[model samples]
Target: MTWLPLLAAGPALAATTSRPWGVLCVGLLAAVLGAVLGIRDGVPGHELAIVLSALVAVTLASGLASALRVRRERVLAAVRSVAEAAQHALLKPVPATVGPFQVAVRYSAADAEARIGGDLYALVPTPYGVRLIVGDVRGKGLPAVGTAALVLGVFREAAYDEPDLLDVVGRIERSLARNLGPDDFVTAVVAGYPGAGRMEVVNCGHAPPLMVRDSHVMAVAPTHPTPPLGLRALTGETPSLQTLPFTDGDQLLLYTDGVTEARNHEREFYPLAERVARHMSDEPSRTLAALHDELLAYVGGRLHDDAALLLLRKPAAVGSAPAAESRASVGEPTRPSLLQ
Candidate 1:
């Protein structure tokens, strides 16, 4: 009689890792064993019946629980699949090389299950030159994701249509003004690599981009302070275009606040410029990968906010190449050309 009570544990334990049918089999075995033990103990008929009844009840309940658990897991799997599809659609993957620059990107969402958050980046070859934007939307979750999608959509279209870098920023500002709430705003840095070895950067109240020159890393602060994307009306300040020389062997890194603000157990912020100098490499991908790994380790495994890093390195010209105009026709597209 004492041993018969332990039988209920078998079905309960099996429910965790087995199907309903498996739980039923475990319960059946347990019930048969319990009956034999009760008979051998010469327990009274009424007590034996009570013990058997309890065991049977536990089995049925465990089986139902197992079925419910499996169903919930399937539903979760389907939700994860849809989230992945949405991530790919919203944040299209960037190729290793875009135009003449070697490009690399690393992104992490605070919500591990979401796969994407408010951080956004886009790099595409335009008729003007290779252009890119790195920005962070206010807040998190689905609203933040929606704002990110809106910003990227406007940037991709404006990058090809607008000749001037500032014009591209204007287009985004106007679009956001119409859509975003009063307090919602996005901080962004829009950049273009036109001819003349000069890169045009428009800072819209975001983190200054870091430029690596001759093994040195320096922040490219905005010439004029400006409000974020949706706050032009409140501040009445406009973003200014700062042009910097981008020559061979030069690299530029644009990242969101999540990277810089990440803290360790000691609460020390990650030193991005120093790490970038330390991890400098000919390949942009390798550089970002090292930084990404270090960032994760610094935060003790997971980030609490959305983080994004985009690195662009201009390699030395190999030899004589076709004219910019000729290459423009082949590279210029509405969407970035995915590398094979």
Candidate 2:
């Protein structure tokens, strides 16, 4: 470990700050004086014994401090390991490709202290088609994380069982209704590709998704206004479904409010659509990388809220796998092996 030497030196360095060096210097000086006196008077002196005892005590204290530092480092390392496991459990990574589209995800939690936060995104090739969801919970921290987990849990199961895009959303709505608090809700955009150059999007009071077509970018906002999930009881309203043409070479970008709301030093919100227009390309991953960097630069380094970006682009040709059978081509879910 690179930190080993630093950790070992911590106690000794701290002891120096506590004036141990001065004590050692004084003791040595006293011993020297005592030796001279003893030589002149032909008598043994207490100063020499006191200096030896002081040296022994300092050695013992230094050892004790080093042991404590090592223990603290071990505890911190274990805590970091557990945090990493939690992050992996919450934010499972998406493959480079899913169904008939190339996929890439870029996520950052505002709370840099923790790996996982409130924002959530997932893309799964289900029996119905390639289904995806990007949402932001009402609050931050652990409670928001729990809500996000609940939404994804329902989406993953419903995406496989329900063929209809609306039905998949309904499952998540019902789950949130039963689980969330009165004041809590989630703003989300759930999307799916059933086939034939058509993409269905259901917006639930979230930011509109941006679509890139032939070097042009536009927001895919729903025609009808809808309340966010979990607040359906309050509004008695349901999310509206939007079906749009997604031809080959076209790209779709789904993101949370964090992207739009991110501000630079001058307190200006990041212009997402304009930036996407500038960065749209054949590779979804590369486009997202550029956007992510610009976003960090815009925010002056750290984002103040959880941000998630999910990009999907249809290839020019379906290749060996037909669009109808794209679900079968999806690889198994990749789960990180936590330290056992």
Candidate 3:
């Protein structure tokens, strides 16, 4: 779908901020100008009466409205500051230029800032190509956030030092085992981009990454899969790394259970594959927007848990060849937008 519907509300939302004063002043000027123009069509006494009444209304309305808006603005300003701080801590930032492809990210927590939980995504450039992780923590509040931070910290370091993707998974498991209780566990998908137009993926009880090429999506998962990260010790099994074919203009999307498990008013699960087929083009920025919008629509506005998505685009040509592909534009690390 086009983004027109989302753009329509931009002005309305801007109306609630300090910036709104500029718009309000412009509107008042327009009203005065219209009245002056109308005076040409009316008698002196009538025009004066109308102008006087309009002035009183404008003064009283602007005064009371300004006071109320100031209070609301103060609250929102504080909220935005805290949300931005938390967002930076939880999902730092990644470069748009990773090897060959451009990377862009959009993350949304169900609650404004202190309230968001359950979902997380991060991409860090490691010595072993660009390593990425996308997964959901099990619960909410500082506890869930702690679990998520635990996973990401282990993944980033392991991705650089460990040569094998599966080994990286093991490292994460050991870290969690030490930090989390025996019952606590996290489902995750960890992948290594070797920058050779190929990907090595290990699924630790997480959803498969959606592969896109030429605007088509191909499901990519290894024939052999492993249990979730924490459960490896419980199951006495280690996960295997899965390799899949990839080409330039192709992208791999790793998302949390939140996206697939999301339900609607009819209680039907969100159609992940179907929507991907429609929006999975050569452009990841657009693809992400479509997926994010579809997700919001499915849940009817607000999400109930933390949700995350990480997208990787493979270059059209690897090694010795230079071919430009789609890009994920990185924005200034401001508070993550509510739109996502």
Candidate 4:
């Protein structure tokens, strides 16, 4: 009779990983066992009834809890599906090749369940050239995501309409100034390859991009520091365009602070440039993949913040003829050479 109370644990444990029906089955089995045990011990009928009634109450409660849990899980799954769809629309996937450069991107949200976060990146082949932007919002969650979407939307439009690279940055700046709150801001690196063996970069208080030249990794620090987006009005300083030689076999890596700020058990930040030098490869995708794997392992299998990595490599020319220029939009079929 004393053991009859232990039967409640059967349904309680089942509620955690089984369906309501499974919990019901477990409860019914426990009740039957309790009855057998009570009779074998020659327990009083009233005492037996009391124990059985408590067991029944616990089982019913466990079944209801299981039902509610299953329903909540289904709702969460639907929410995640919608978030994924929104992410695809906001951060359209880039092809392996954009214009003359081989491009690769890797992004991870701090919230594993959210699947998308404040970190944002976009690479598109515009009439100006292959232009790309990598930026990190000031915060996380829904507000950060909305700010990132605003920046990308302005960038995609400005990259094509504006002839000058700085003008593209200007467009994003003005848009953010009008929309973002005084406390909100974004740090970004906007870069473009305009077909003159030169890569134009406009840094807005973001991490210095790593340039790989002749097997050497060097940080492309901005000559003139400027405030981040949405704070230009306060600082009254505009972003300056920095042009660098981007010849054949050269590569550039742009990433958010999350990569640099990631810490291990010892609280040591990830060495991005050093890792990039070690993982250098002819293919940008393979190189980023190796770096990303090492990064995750270095941080003990997870990053605490949203991290984004964009690597662009200019392949050595095969012939005098330039690669065919192409453009890709979301949901559109990519050209054979541009397929990722």
Candidate 5:
């Protein structure tokens, strides 16, 4: 029947990714085929012309649908481009080394399609020393992204201007309290190297960072508990800075819940400490690369939430210049606390 050809053309054109004209041509050919079949079946000349005319109409409709699909795809591409640019500006990439530390960073937004999300990480060399931060917002999508951006912007500015690490955290807390929703909060670990062999960390309701020294791994849990950034009012307690010995060949790993909370098919959370102990190395970059690969495999190649990992190592030669200075042309890939 003439209707059968129209039905077939509709689906074929709907699935085609080629130019609309190509699909239009296919629809036309189908219509002509139907007409040839009608003539062979001895249909009247006037009726055969009507059948061909109907096919032409079907072809035109198919072309219009194809055009709409292409237009939508172009619009989405433009949107993605804008999102990527925003990500670059907000999450400025870290150099391989800063001051006395060798560093590496690996970040993955749970939505692979999006270039940025709620997870945030940063590292900057300041007059005080090198400061860094890694944090995660409470929710997902655009609102979460906005909060993460705000936290990072304040952290960067305060890290440079305020000599006190606690002051840096105070600035972020004030900003979030002013701008964030009542229920919004961010869990973060802010740390800095005030001197060549000393490091200070302030934990804000975040996962405890892992310390690796001489092939051993241990959690750097703070002795005092502190609320996440936006809820400091509820607890009425400020975060305390924990100082540690960060000598040559020692590394510190800072991560969000995404790293430890990722589940496998069995619904078991990945054992980050045990795994890091197995893959620990003097090189921060190589260690993180291995960890990220294993994490993806554990989650079946897709993450459900934004993930961020930052590794900072005190080189054996502490006073010497960072290796990255010579490789400044190469891109390498933060925390608040003033440990004076």
Candidate 6:
């Protein structure tokens, strides 16, 4: 959480303005100052010429050094700014608190900042319920980022105004159909956590989200899933929503392919499900900490894509669990009242 933004801006700031490019500017300034000093001190001899020469040499060297650093810094800063904008667009700044869940997300791009990869998640409180989307766009750089923004924009609007999950998905499909390249498509899972304690999920060929219960981790997968969002037109019936039994104190983990697809030094994939199942914690924050740490350790701090993680805690339910059969017999139509 603490590891974001470069703290070493001292060099960048000094190198940018009025010859801020570190060494060059410094050297030039030093030379000018030296000449002024020589004049004031009245040394108009061979010694003065030698001092001027040294000052000129030093100034040129310093200027070059500073310019190189400034160039590097500007590129990094540009990248950071882009990543920040993408994050804002993807996350949409939901209220810090919603329902019994306190959600927090972290995204780290494979490149220092300027690198273009978009791993996205968006949560919007809608008339139908609280709708959210989490997924990774294919490719890297601006193309991927553009796709991410496109998907998020469609989902945000559709979630609020559309009642059916399929309809919301349809909106995104139409939007992408007009823009996405023939080979480009995003993989994702769009979900509606309609308040109370139930979740409606539509899997669009994305990684299965993890559900944490009493410290146990299980993947929340749909029984039937469609292809990723943009390719929906290629497929027939949309994926059906699978209702989940969410309770207070339960946590839902949504992530991008970056986390699961990470490769280790041995070239083996990061074992996200296995690791999460083994390390899940009762506390949402703690669970995330453990997962994030293990992820970083697995890849040795190198990631290949924009990795994102969103943790949601439903808060603890007041009453006892309904009979196991109760969930089997119940349907989503009857669940909205549970929010009360």
Q: Report the C-alpha lDDT of model 6 over 1-340, residue by residue, as the tens digit.
A: 1111121232234444535345445555555665666677776657666765665555555456566776888898886887678566565665656655677665668885453466788887788877888888878887888888889888888888898987898888889889998788888888887755687888888887877665555676568766887776676656677888776666778998788778889988777666766766655567677878888888898786778888777754468674332233122221111211
> Which residues of candidate 6, in runs, are more than 4 Å off?
1-55, 64-79, 94-96, 317-340
**Model number with the top lDDT:** 4
lDDT for 27 in candidate 2 is 41
Writing each residue's lDDT as its tens digit, candidate 5 over 95-136 gives 888987889999999987788999999999999999999999
lDDT of 2 by residue, 233-337 (tens): 888887778888776777888999888889899988888877887788889899999999999999999999889999999897835443442222111221211
Better of 1 and 4 by lDDT: 4
- Higher TM-score: candidate 3 or 4? 4
**What local lDDT does model 3 show for residue 181?**
78
TM-score of 2: 0.78
C-alpha lDDT (0 to 100) for residue 59 of candidate 1? 98
Q: Compute each candidate's TM-score over C-alphas.
A: 0.91, 0.78, 0.69, 0.91, 0.87, 0.75
Candidate 2 wrongly placed segments (more than 4 Å): 1-65, 318-340
Instruction: List clashing residue pairs in candidate 3.
Output: 204-228, 248-315, 248-316
Of 4 and 5, which scores higher on lDDT? Answer: 4
Residue range with the least summed lDDT across 10 consecutive positions in model 3:
330-339
Candidate models: Cα lDDT each: 0.88, 0.78, 0.68, 0.89, 0.83, 0.70
Model 4, range 1-340, lDDT digits (tens) per residue?
7677989999999999999999999999999999999999999999999999998999999999999999999999999999899889988989998888899999999998898999999999999899999999999999999999999999999999999999999999999989999999999999999986888999999988888876777777788998999999998998999888787778899999889898899988887777777899999999989989999999999899999999999997786575343311112221212210
Model 1: colliding residue pairs: none
The alpha-carbon RMSD values of the candidates against the true structure, listed in the order shown, are 7.1, 10.0, 12.0, 7.6, 6.9, 9.5
lDDT of 5 at 197: 69
Tens-digit lDDT string for candidate 3 (1-340): 1221232233334345535464356445545554555566553656555554554455445545565788887898898888678667777777766766667666778785564466777787777787888887777777888888778777777888998787888888888878887777888888777765567788887776776655555565546777776777788877887766555666777787677777899987777767777777666677788889989988998777667777777655545455453333212222112112
Error of 3 at 306 (Å): 1.9
Worst 10 residues of 2 by lDDT: 331-340
